[model samples]
Target: MLPTLRSLMRQRELALHLLTPEDALPAGALDAAIEWVHSSDLDDPTPFLSAGQVLLSTGTQFEAAPGAESVFAYVQRLRDVGVAGLGFGTEVVRAGTPDALLDACLQIGLPLFEVPYRTPFIAVARAASDMAAEERFARRSWSLGAQRAIAIAALRPDGLSASLEELSRQLGHWVALFNANGALDRVFPAGALAASQPAGPAAAAGADGLVDTVRREATRLLRRGQRASSTITAGGETLTLQTLGRREQLRGVLALGGSSELDQAGNEVVTAVIALAGLALEQNHSLDRARGQIRAAVLRALRHGDLALATSVSDGLWGELPAEPVRCAVVETRGGQLDAVTEHLEALVVEHPGRLFFAVDDGRLVLCLGEDGLPLLTELCSAFALRAGLSEPGAYSDLDRAMAQAEQALARAGDAVGVSEFGEIARDGVLSYLTTTDAGAIGRSVLQPLSEHDAAQHSELLRTLRLWLEQNGQLDATAQLLGVHRHTVRARIAQIEKLLGRDLSGFQERAELWAALLVAAE
Candidate 1:
């Protein structure tokens, strides 16, 4: 450690005497490292001074007994510059320390020391400089050892977790790793530190809120493809967040909490850890991409009824196929870009491991997850403002049918239903399947008269008839739905019956009209 005010005062060789009482010393004065000792007689030496320095002066500027005002201004300036302490050389311009200067130092809580005539300011400067150099060298050695330890830990079975544990131990601080999606991958010290909570109520509640704020900001930075570092004081601790990656390819984030800022040596170790983490993340991404490709191939094989080839392709990727049948889900964004949604789904796959097989076909995401995974899929859909179609749980050999069902369901998605299941629409599967066949022709012929009449007269007769049919020919219900009187609804139905020359009393006619209406709506 660099020499501090307390240490310098205790050095018998220098014979420095502490004029400031222990209580008068500024907070952290005992541990505040002195970068160097600066001796100056200038009226305002703060401009040439920097923080963490012990400023020595001979009081020559106060030879004329500069009043309390000048003394207070000078001391305040030194404090503003963050000088570690102020040293006065006595027995030169005045016999002892000035009462005004001492009072000023006391008022500002700046540590004050009296330098004896026998001990020159140059001697003090040399001693501080030497100690600082030694401390730097020691810190460098310690940091190098830590780097080696971390490297070895990275090679262990636990890999990144081991390395992070070693780092946490070296820093005496908590460390956490967050993936690109802002999900925590691992943390050092395990559960000892909650990023969202402090250890006691003495800590501010706002500090706990910082965890989510910092995480969101970090995630935004990563999404923008930028390297970022953020520092925030929370729970009286300095929390630092660093992005891990090269250039614009951000792969992860490292969060550290400590009482003090990291020194140069600590920064070096963190840099090494960041590099290692980036490489690991890249490797994992490559492996995931490869696995996705294999899964895609397997899905294609299954679609073609090539069960043997599909099983062979998936053998190494998944331990066993789901015995209880699987549901196929087709998801697509309504208007947003699909990339973010795809990445989120991929993260879900990572979380669930072998429970899901996913592939991006064209601009849509295709997922074959276990039957119980429907809730997760639903949540993803809601989160991403996505439209999803789910097929019924079926055998591996039935993937082609399931995929067709999923596609049909997806086509049927609308404002009322953002996610539709195949079973929910299977009753109308015949009409849906004949979309390009006789359904279109039948719909046009059945509703052509009403459509032409409405177009010419600017009337809503067809709409009224559809509402009437939907309401089970209940004039009151149809009239209420249309916000019209029952007489108006009866008149529209009478016109519809006359135009189609079909009786409104038969179940078969009503069913046929309903089918035609369904085809027309599609």
Candidate 2:
């Protein structure tokens, strides 16, 4: 401990005289502080003394600026410059401490000591200087000891947690280590205010917002080899957050979690923790990837089939199967190439955070979306389209369909337009014939009579009848889709029925004609 002004004066039996009581001096109030500076400048004590050093001044500096600031202001200026305490001379300055200065010192938490006329300024300076030298030696010794402990922790096979715990205990803080995936792998409860499972995916607010801020900043630093510190809120309490990354191939994170900023020892522990965790994550990428893939596969299997099957494939595989009925989406890029599609897919996931099943095939992204996945997928498709022209959405499906049906629909949509045919093509071969068959042949076969009639009359009777059938005979909806009034739509349907010599209202007739419409659309 550095020698305080009151403590030193007592060693010389001077605390009794200097701290005489009527306005009794508190314990250790009269001793000369070891870390103090001589400051005669009343204008700005900052120019004279560095931060954290006590200031000693005479009344002459304040006399020059008496026109403006009071002695209170003068004391405040010195304190603002990191002055620990200030001493005033009784001989050259006011006979007694000024009430204004006294109030300022007490209010601002700055310590003030009296310099009696009989006391020599040189003696006080000499006393403080000697104590400072001794204090410096102790500080170096403590720092060296801490550094050695950290070095030893670095060499341990499993010493990261131990080193951090010890460091936090020494420095008075909390410590947590996070893996690359943002999970807390270790936590030592040195200063944590709440009891939470820190290793879980969810973390609560900590001291100075340390919990949330540390986890977030730690993950970021570990990933990019960057460092950050901030104040955060956790459990309705404020806390300090400090994050550091290791210098290794797979850098990890060390988090100093507490209500106060970490001291030097705490920082070193943070560094050591980062080194161990980062190295572990970096070295275990292959294993991590494999485990992640397995988990994903299990989740994937759960999507279309039984959970048991997904669970049986591999541990952690298929862990994230999307909830059903999964929505399918197609993405088309500029060049018709599948390359770089995965990157865009990943980016899409990041931009729209939710459950999504995205896979790249050829030049497209086939995503089996989670809840609201279709709309998100649409937005993603639009973004990809804006970036480059290779992305597009083709064939689609019903709001509900079997997994097999949805998959087929996705396939057909990838190959053609309308987005609903992957299943239709497989079910009845209609989508395939309509999309892949020679359009002229199919059109001639289905719309030949219409061509002949239109050749004679000039009307879209075939198309009109097809629209009529699609509306399920609902005059209103079909009209809306066709952008015509109900009367116009009915008339078109009537005209189409008459031209084809069939009652379009009949279910069979409607079905067969709908089939032919697909063919004609080819």
Candidate 3:
């Protein structure tokens, strides 16, 4: 800190005397910061000085302007220019300090001190300059020390968390870290206002409001899908938010909050932390990708009937494969929503490590979760508006067959936004096996003649055939459902049989056509 007016007067070597009475002192008058000291004899010296400076001058200016009003105007000009105080050199061009100057300063509330003959103006300026220089040195040293501590913190086992805590301690403020999903990953200084209740009622309310605002802002930044920083003021504190990772793929957000603004050194420390945190996130991202690749490899092995190999590879990392009689779920979402869904599932994998194991195959999210986790999978599919298929419980050795069942169910799921369980459709026995075969494609080829005839003649033969098959060849039921007469349904059915060259009298042909429609709906 720089020397104040009160401190200058306390220096014995300077021997400065306060001309203004203590009772007449203005607010913050005694502790006025003195950045520099200047001596000028001109009547107007305001142009040469800056704010937070002390002016030193002989009584020559007072000699020119001898009246009390003139002296008052001079003090007003110095005050207007934010001069910390005025120092009048006595015993030079005058016997003592002028009465008009003393009265003007006392009335205007501008601090005035008498400089004794023994103390040179140079000494006062040098003293203030030295104090300023020492402050700069102290701040720079602190910055270097803080940077060193942060760097050391970054080498710890939990480097990211440790470094953030160190940064918060050094800054004497709260720091929060969020993951790519905008979920709060960590917060420094445990039991902070953001993490725990405050002591006072007013503070408690303020803390709650601040936490909500911070979360909303963090989410908004990630949703913007850009690399940026924001400064916000809430609950009487300033908060700084910065996005980590690249603009194209944001990893997370880092937030720092405090009651005061950061100085130059504090800003430098923050910059260092951001760089370190960004590098850490990038490293973690690479590790996550490697783990995903390993998971995919394991899933491939399981599908290839290499359960032992899969178990050996994934046992330590992700816990045992969801045990025998595991159910497989295949989930898929819109193209733009893949990242959001992936982040949610990744978080779940971390939370429920042993109970669930999932891997992305092609564009779909495939999972081999325990029977107990089926309900959670169903909820996830509904929550994310994802199209999913669940296979019947099967042994780990039969994972290949189970995956085929899930794909067949998924294909039959069509464009609907929900889960399709293979068990629901598998009760038809032979139909289940037939649905998975290329028979659906062959049936579609067989029905092409009917589709073209209907499109050309704008007839209802295909619709009549589907309804007839659905109603089990009940003429009255199909006709009533179609809002047509039984005779018209009979005529359309006859035309359908002739066009497709398939005898609808048999259940095999009708089931094949129905299966074809189901597969093609996807």
Best by lDDT: 3
lDDT of 2 by residue, 217-260 (tens): 66565556455555555554344544443343333455554555
Q: Which is superior by TM-score, 1 or 3?
A: 1
Q: After superposition, how far is residue 441 of candidate 2 from its true place, in Å?
A: 17
- The candidate 1 region of ten consecutive residues with least summed lDDT is 334-343
**Candidate 1: stretches off by over 4 Å:** 42-47, 61-70, 91-94, 161-165, 172-208, 223-243, 246-249, 252-259, 333-354, 372-387, 413-419, 427-494, 500-512, 516-522
Candidate 3: lDDT of 377? 85
What is the overall TM-score of model 1 with all chains considered together? 0.76
Model 2 weakest 10-residue run by lDDT:
387-396
lDDT tens digits by residue: candidate 1, 415-521 = 54467887877776666755634587788789999999999999998899888998999999999999999999988888889999999888999888888888777
Model 3 lDDT tens row, 1-522: 568988888788889999897779888898876888999987889999899989999878767657787888988999899988999888878878888888888888889999988888999898788877887899899999999999999999979889999999999989998878776677888757554435576776777788788888998999999999999988778899999988878888998888877878888999899999999999988877887789899999988889889989888776777777798888877745665576577767667766678888887788998976777788788877888888999887788788888887888777888888888777756555565567777767767888888899998777887888889999999999999999999888888878777788888888777877665443
**Every candidate's CA RMSD:** 5.5, 11.7, 6.6
Question: Which prediction has the highest TM-score against the true structure?
Answer: 1
Clashing pairs in 3: none
lDDT of 1 at 39: 93
Q: Give every collision pair in model 1.
A: none
Candidate 3 overall Cα lDDT vs. reference? 0.83
